[model samples]
Target chain A: MTDQRDDKEFAAFLAGESELADRYQALGSEQPPVELDEHILAAARDAAKVHRLEFGPPGGWLKPVALAATVLLSFSLVMKIGVDSPVRYEQVVTVSKESDSTLEGQSEPVFYEQLARSLPQRTLEMKNMREEQQSEQVIEEVTVTGRSRSIELKDAPMAVSILGSAEQSIDQDAALLIVAEYVAMLKTKSDSGRFRLQEMERSNESTAKEPALTASSPVASKKDWESIDKLQTEDDSESMLREIVRLYTSGSNNEAGTRLDEFLAHYPDHPVSVKLRRRGY
Target chain B: MLPGMANRPDDKVLMVRYRDGEVQAFEVLYARHKGPLYRYFLRRGLGTEPAAELAQEVWMKIIRTKDRYEPSAKFTTYMYRLAHNCLIDLSRRSAYKITQQVIGDDIDVAGLPATATANPEAEAIYNESVEQFRSALANLPDEQREAFILKQESGLSLADIAHVTGVSTETAKSRLRYAFSKLRQQLIRNRDKA
Candidate 1:
């Protein structure tokens, strides 16, 4: 309790209620030398200046903004690659080849030859239409057996339309004709094959002069009728032979039998006729 | 006496403004606390030169670490804590011995300027009582003397004294009480002898 009383008295003395407070206030007053204050204040100014430079206005927020911009730019580049460049011209060509079963196993030159031959006769009308709309540069050159020719079918932009028009009229013989043309085009690699192509053309010409092969005939298909009409008016022996082959392969057995008999009566010595006889046609 | 005590800003606010490169704020703070801080070291057994050095060291530390200063406690408490640590560090170094002699023994008491009193004899007696108080204050233990000085000089409360001295409020109060009792006893003995 005495200690507590002393504590209260000391608290009162600290509050300046005692004479000791007055005496203590009269104690010596000393100040730091002016030189020391200047030295320390100069040091303070230097440190504050350094700190101002270190955390300058741009230093704090610019780093994150630049980082975010870089990330956005990279993301946009990846999106452009993924979204815009999806299909290539080369891939379209591949898909076109894969869809056609007959074009399988053919070399590129042979494939072009077959593509040209298998195109429908209506493609001729489209060729006339295309010639009006496009420049001659639209034609692409193809090389077969060391002989390069500019065929209308190559690089033709209307290829899908050509196939679409041929869907109803193309018979088995037209398809086989495409294969045969591919084989003949590939065979032209040798001199013997060239001579054979020339001989076939000559025999076709000779058969055109024969009256029996020129007899009037009925055709099953409108396309075959067009070819026959063309043969009658123009006397194209190649067209006649193609029509006969079309009738034979189109399941018209009786019409093909009559056309074959009449053709063989005039051209018994024809190489194609001899080949047909050997094949039991 | 230090200047610019009229309507001063908060000490922590002054420190923060100084941290933001306003040197004028620091000048105000230095002017406000320089005398009390110097006297604090002077009365704690340091010679005038060493006490001045310690006072400057404490301000320099305050300036250096201004960026890290949080206003959690009173700025006076923070400043005194730094002063306290510097004294402890000086004690550890033992480069300057802490003496137990009366603070008045280092100076000529007659050379001190007389207090402004109309009665010269009363002023003389007042000077003697003041000198005796200083001697008694120096006679107290270092912790008690430091507590008393912090309370009287910096106007720190008992809790602030505890915070600055790393003691509990009760312990700070006890030290101040013992210091007051000792000084009062010494003054009474001197009065009786005279």
Candidate 2:
């Protein structure tokens, strides 16, 4: 019960009603020297204004420039990726013949790669054609005779016409595939032997009855040599097999590797496996 | 919990303005509390030079950390914490030369000599007891003196005292109790001689 009295007295002292509170209150407060206040306050004011630009926002004009550069980079990337859909020859839209005139005037390696990836079949064939011809040979433009006038197929729908012997070298097989599609298109339109497919140096005197190319008819220009090479890969299915091998070996897909094992059991003599054996796989 | 300064914008408002880069806002805050904060360090046993140095340092620290300061407590509570930390750092830097006793949490304020207000001689004793109490204020243990001074200077409640001194509210109340008890006894003990 006496402890309660101390609690009341202590509370009174803390509340400044007691004599002890009167004594502490009697002492006046101390102030920091004026110079210290000026020094500290001056520093506080200075801090608001003085600092490196990077610690805050960049200058006014820089943000737009950085934004523009970022946008330009993104656009270039998206254009380079092309479409995601499965590619087909039917999907090949023909560009205007007049477009060829402009394409033939410029020479840049970038244009060659753009034209190559634009058509999947031609990209593969173009790579092959580049390897075979060693890329020094000049490309010949094919001419198609329309009913009203002789229109060169040089600017035909496929990417080949886009090259048009511009100093930019491209895949020969790309050019041939374009020619085949153009030939197919022309054969239906011109019954008169006005349509002729041949090397630029070949005679124009050749007649319209030149065998209307059978749907499956081989391209006559490289029929014998290219046909034999195509037949060999077709018989072995080496291209498909090589692609599966590439996917498995690169560890890009576990499913591909599992399939490769199943494939090796049935076809252990597959060319890539045989090749790996020679390399001490 | 702050009262009676209703028209004056609080430290939090000034702090927010300072954060938004108005240097004048910081000047207002500095002017409002500099005396109390400086006196806190001074009375806490830092000599005048070290007290001034630490006061400058506390302002600089507030400026340096302004952007990260959230108004999580009363501005007085926050500033006093900086003062508390600065005192601790001074104590540590001086290798614990602060020989003040550890003020304990014994809140048992029982059976002490009763406060005397009866004698007319108490009036004559008051002036001298005031001087004695001021001397005793300097001599009180660190925690007791800190609690007393913070209460007298900032008008912080025991809860705010707990926050400023980094102790529980109960401990803060205990320290304040012990502080007033010592001051009362000191005043009366010196009253007779005076």
Candidate 3:
């Protein structure tokens, strides 16, 4: 019952019809000192200045220029990389020819040796015949012979008998085995040939090739052979391997050391490995 | 400024003008509500310096954040909410000490001389009674004091009070009830003394 009375009194007091309400109203009427407005406006202006300074000039253009430069630089770098890469067209063709010759040579070593020996003579004869035929007629013919096989070559004519040896000579089951072995051998020969060709192409294309030969050339008068010799001796993979072994033994695995480890793992029997092992490894 | 013109612009129009760099629109808003915002801080027992500082900060905040302002509610509601936040922020920063005795003592009873209809002796008695009642109001909890002040000073409806206080209407009403009951008890004690 008392709680009910308290609740009623509280409700009536909240109505604000009492003396307390008037005093609150009077308290609300108190005025603050007048300088606050100036201080706050000054702060706001400073903030506005900061906003303008940070975001105003060139805000519109910076993004597009940055974006355009990024795109242009990326495109230029890609084009430069593409252009600077050594072309391997001749290398690829050499590898393909070596692989094909290896395949044909594998089936009959004696025949291939005989053929290889006879090629220079045959080429000379063909050259002479072509020289004679060129003056008289547009048509030309030539003959080629192997140990047990012969072929007649004519202009624009393809000989299919060279490819028919395995099919004709071997039993059907044995022929498949020969074909598989031939393919595996061809694949191995092609891979090694490709690597060798690529190395040759890179060496031919780079000025880094044949420093010793260039050093001896009379035309290369201005060349500093001593510095060249020093550089070559320093850059010799053997020296690099020795430096790597020294670092590893000293427990100083810097970038060169890391690169040496990678090099060793990648090409363990590389020519420098012998020197590397002799030095420390 | 024309009377009430500062208060009369549609909040949306004022906001749009303010966005377009019409500083006058913001000045008008400041003028329209400066008295109410000042009163809000003053009634909460904040000193004159802090109250004025908080009021100015509230306006500055409105100016700084004007670009983000949307008039989804009445401008007056938004203004009071900003003022409330500034006051709370000021209190937090200063950790201002608010005491019931200080609140009660700060009220100037001399300013409100008793009505002439009462005998001089009786007026004196009434004035003392009013002072005592003010003291009791100071003793009320901060939320109750704020709810009571918003109701009396702004004439805000319960919903408006709730919106300003960030409380439900029921909670606001409850606070008001507690504030009034405490004040009524003090006034009743004063009436007995008279």
Candidate 1: which docking quality band? acceptable
Off by over 4 Å in 2: A9-22, A51-182, A185-281, B1-4, B99-127, B188-194
Which candidate model has the greater lDDT, 2 or 3? 2
Pairs of residues clashing in candidate 3: A13-B180
lDDT by residue for model 3 (A50-128), tens: 5445544334555787899999999999988875554221100012344445555233322223332333444444455
Higher-ranked by TM-score: 2 or 3: 2
Please name the candidate that would achieve the greatest lDDT relative to the true structure. Answer: 1
Cα RMSD, model 1:
17.2
Q: Write candidate 2's Cα lDDT for A1-281 as tens digits.
A: 86898788877766666766555545545678889998998888767654223234234455787899999999988866644332222222333456545544221111223333343444444455433232322222222111011222222322343233311322223232223323333332334322333421131233222233333322223321232233233433333343343343233344544544555565566533443343333
DockQ values of all predictions:
0.31, 0.29, 0.19
Alpha-carbon RMSD, candidate 2: 18.0
lDDT for A15 in candidate 3 is 58
The Cα error of candidate 1 at residue A19, in Å, is: 2.5
Judged by whole-model lDDT over C-alpha atoms, candidate 1 comes out at 0.62
Tens digit per residue, CA lDDT, model 2, B33-134:
998898777666665677789999899998888877898888899888988887788778877555432211111123122335667677446544544565
Ranking by DockQ: 1, 2, 3
- For residues B91-166, could you state the per-residue lDDT of candidate 3 as single tens digits? 6887866555555434434444446455888666655655566667667888998888777766677888899999
Each model's lDDT comes to 0.62, 0.56, 0.52
